[model samples]
Target: MEQTANKQTRLSQRVRSIQPSGIRRFFDLASKMDNVISLGVGEPDFVTPWNVREASISSLERGMTAYTANAGLLELRVAISDYMNNRFQVDYNPDNEVLVTVGASEAIDLGMRSIINPGDEVIIVEPTFVSYAPLVSMAGGVPVAVGTTAASHFEVLPEDIEAAITDKTKAIMICYPNNPTGATISRAKLEQIATIVKTHDLIVFSDEIYAELSYEKDHVCFSSLPAMKEQTIVINGFSKAFAMTGWRLGFVLAPPDLLDAMLKIHQYSLMCAPTMAQYGALEAMRNGMEDIEKMTLSYQQRRNFFVKTAKEIGLPCHKPDGAFYAFPSIAHTGWTSEEFAEKLLIEERVAVVPGSVFGKGGEGHIRCSYATSLVNLEEALKRIGRFLEAHDIRGN
Candidate 1:
């Protein structure tokens, strides 16, 4: 056989060097295996509420499936504005500050693209969402990852944020009521961040996708701060709270100039979020919040159970104040996070995401998602206990 030339095999170095998302690789593998109780995915397991589905059906029946304006359906944008005000104590004009995109995922990408110039630095606090770094790279920006440890309960400290800054630091991408760790900053801490961003005149992309799932106090919006509003872009969506992950509906709220640039990108890249999704999202805003509250209560119940059980199994646990994830340190288990996850899935049929998949800071931890049923959570914990015991790490 003739050898292929380097010329034929050439690809973009960025594409070649970048690793396939660790989270996605395991999820794809686990999904193909049977009897796996997967906690690997961070999405809600709940059904998209009935009313929202009905609205989508109604829209299709009424021929409302045609494309709307690039900014999104006016009624839905107005609904989003009203909902954010009633829920988060923030006031956005909706006209200039909001552009709907496909789920919070796309909004995050859009925000990154709008502000990033080639070689600009985007500081990201790690063990964060898998998308942030890759997306930043794709947008011709450099991603600076700041490590947060298990001892600090995975909250990004002001000092750490300060240390990661450089002349090229154009923005910071932050997700609160965080994904894998479920860590959150209190209002006082956010104020500290406000101070940093205000001092540096830095732009902030705050991903509050899990905002509604916060357990103790209601979620706070970065834009709620009068000073922060001008430099902040808020990315939120219906996926977590309304159980609408499949709907592909999310929106970006920003200052006018930023929103305009994002809309140009959106129009060119995706044109608009689905017309049917807009109608369904409008329904969710209008009447589906009680359903959201029910889901939050369920997740909180599961969180409480997982925390208690994880401790019983000798894991050092952090109580999550919001979101459905519980990140427990398994350093005592004599295994890396992925090793721990792999053993549990192979030996006992329970599935979870390794914390290291999130970033370097997550080396000794694993993310336990309580978005599954109570029965599953209990069974998974039992399997985890057995896995730990075999390693002589439980109940020492």
Candidate 2:
């Protein structure tokens, strides 16, 4: 027998310091419980439509499995270009300005990686997606979180934006039809942010994956601002709007030089998005507006029901103007968000994500995704009522 010396290989210091996403803990716990009605996830419950799936299947049959160029299939990029122009009035040169990514998730990661240098600060608005901070950290950037209140309907004020800026600040990270809050930036608001960004020469990383899902108004693209366009990277995908999450297809639009550099990074780091999904996205661009209309209408109906039911159940939810999430104040419950979430899962068999999981300002709130069936929504609200009443929580 050979004797071995003790040794260990440790992770990189950056990797070691980063913690796993807070969004997954509730999900892991909820999975083991029986008869649980969970609204804890951000993903839609819908399957990719038959046409989109058929397009993927057709690609498989044709054996287009090998890798294509790093920037993605030309036809898909062209489609993306046209799609943006038609919908958002932002024009991108598909050949030199767009790079397909693994998902909006990876698009976000790559977008930050391509921009930030060590110690540079990335401004993030809360409660935002959980991925932004870690990815910023990974790119050697410091995260500066600006917390918006429920009283403002979670809007990030321009004064607050101005206050959060430092000389180290490199970019503004924004997501709308925001994840946990369902809050969106209006045209005036987007312009205001763009003006500040232009004045400071700061880059804007705009994640508008939920653009098509807005119920109150049409989605605004920040890149549509001429002064902001040159310094902005618009990252969007076919996920939320078209119910194509697992398809893992997304694209980014940047200035010519940034697109060129990002394509090289994408080529080595991610290679290419799944080819079949690109074909499906091509179909989505061609004929999926109706599908978006259909899905958005359904989501809006569910959103209405949830806002009503949740407010009635002591959660004090606002009627979301966009995305299918209700960010409700649970202040009536003496328990903190995590505690409320834990007891609800164990006792009432209903699961909602603790808003605090998103970041600092989220403590007394909870995010309940309405991306589920109407029947399930009704049942979950009633169970939440039972849980609140049993715990002696008062309501409006």
Candidate 3:
């Protein structure tokens, strides 16, 4: 009976093939301990702006607790469209081209599943968000990783991307300012990539969840490039920039055909995004500019501090142009990425993620999020410095 039960309950090959999230593994470990200063997760420490929260509360009081249209509340979709145009220089018809989702994550998954077929190859630039490869694999597509190094500030080379392409190649996925590395691509380079995409006639999935958090230069939307709109799927959300991670609100912009395909999956699976969160997001879209500016400035300050401190502490780190992460090489310690992360967590009670989990070219590095308060960052840095000294890896 036991043997029969095991055989009948076998998991799907896709699910079995992927390992669990490395970020969540360390987070789970830290949750069990006391006084741990965690720089593991990329979530902001800020509260959702009062007005945004109040809008959602008001919706609940008004008894607005039901499902929205499968494409999301039309008002929210319109707001997202307007915001995209004004903020990122991108335009999409809210009527047919925009689809609100549970979060940027769901939008990405829908985009992948909507376009990818069995054996199709999607080029993934790494170290990137942990989800890109797994989601592609889950959608029955093959993930081809093209790694970038710190010497280039982790920016992908266009020639390398072109080399990775072939007949089976269907799409290319990119995130900037990237998670784990926090690197942003320049417009000249993006235009160069656009030429390659057009020449090869491929799709591009641009995950710009951190667009508002850029520290160096303004973000260049991939779809905003000339003639590239039809060939791109833009994935963005309010979670990171709006400090509304718990609200689970995100939206996508794609051509009408692709949008319709994703909507079909969303309707059957998710129905729509949460109703109250939609109202909250509506308010955020309308009056959230000041909040974004304030939060971004704070993050830039923290980024400056964290990068400087990481270098001073004997870890070689590149100053990231956007996002809140600092990827520092721990090669000097002669410890593998996992070993450095684990030992630091155990001895110093400071939690950071091992870079290897972010995929190719991530070895001998660790990702530290500077999204927490400056006070917490100061303390965490002190602990890290002490830990490094104990190991005789102090700065030069």
Candidate 4:
């Protein structure tokens, strides 16, 4: 009787409704296979900078293992404030307007839960980060997806965003340089989107985790726009730029009232971000700009090489201007994204993410992360060419 009861335990409907990450599914498959060249997960191949790691080690040596204040170390917060102002032209007060969390992922969750109410709607521009919609749903907000096509370079249009807005709409969440696509919007385009948000009086969750990796031009911080600071929540972290993915340090910049609400949830749920990571982040904020520039230049070179080789090998892809991904159209293969991914992995030992898993406008494509070494990417693309040739799919 006890066994049966345990087996029949009810889970939250929200948890049951969402599917596991498609990116991870392929990553696991690749991990289990021999000689597989994976282009699936979007992690930087570089290790965290030595100085940042040293700072964390120094803290541990000093016996600083106690939990920080609920909002995180004020010194770290102050550094983040200065960094934002200097790098992105956005000013956030450190004392009451900034909150550091475990990672950008946690920051995103806090933002969603703090603002969402049951039956409220949040407009999500896709193909987008996978966590955006699910987090909104888990927060009791309806996720309304607004699709952007490859033809538009995957930049969400202001008209499309306006059309998606309803009386129930409460916020708009955007990521650029976007995950999986590496697309960036111009300052003018962001200004237009800002107008729509202002007109509708909706909140904006702007994820700028990849800001320092842009190749073509400088990234425009959404909160830096005129009159947008009060209405926008800026989510950023050291994971991408500083190659500090394992450090788990990220932060939020919002108005004091909005930040206070997020802090309440963060305080109760997490207490504060890891103390050592805070010290490391403070070091990163102060001295990691050079490391970011070096890593970004390497990624840009890899991107150029990968995109060029992909087109030469019959995979048509847009030249990504930012971030480290190349979303190539696989429509010519006459296979669904998942089908192509599976066959490619099985036949050629190259692992990539199926586009359909990223939501609307992703059906005929696959996302390839160039965050790995050029040697690995070259091998992967060469194998992909063989797969295409065997399938008799010709490039346009």
TM-score of each: 0.96, 0.97, 0.98, 0.98
Writing each residue's lDDT as its tens digit, candidate 3 over 212-233 gives 9998798999999999999999
Of candidates 4 and 1, the better by TM-score:
4
True lDDT of residue 100, candidate 1: 89
The 10 consecutive residues of candidate 3 with the worst lDDT sum are 4-13
Candidates 2 and 4 compared: the better one by TM-score is 4
Cα lDDT of model 4 by residue, 145-210, tens digit: 999988998988889999999999999999999987899988989999999989989899999999
Ranking by lDDT: 3, 4, 1, 2
**Pairs clashing within candidate 2:** none
- 189-212, model 2: which lDDT tens digit per residue? 888888899888999999998989
Which is better, 2 or 4, measured by lDDT? Answer: 4
The top-ranked prediction according to lDDT is 3
lDDT by candidate, in order shown: 0.87, 0.87, 0.93, 0.92
Model 2 scores a C-alpha lDDT of 0.87
* Candidate 3 lDDT score relative to the true structure: 0.93
Candidate 1 to native Cα RMSD, angstroms:
1.6
Root-mean-square deviation of every model: 1.6, 2.4, 1.4, 1.5
- Candidate 1 lDDT, tens digit per residue, 55-79? 9999999999788999999998899
TM-score of 4: 0.98
53, model 3: CA deviation in Å?
0.5
Clashing pairs in 4: none
lDDT of 4: 0.92
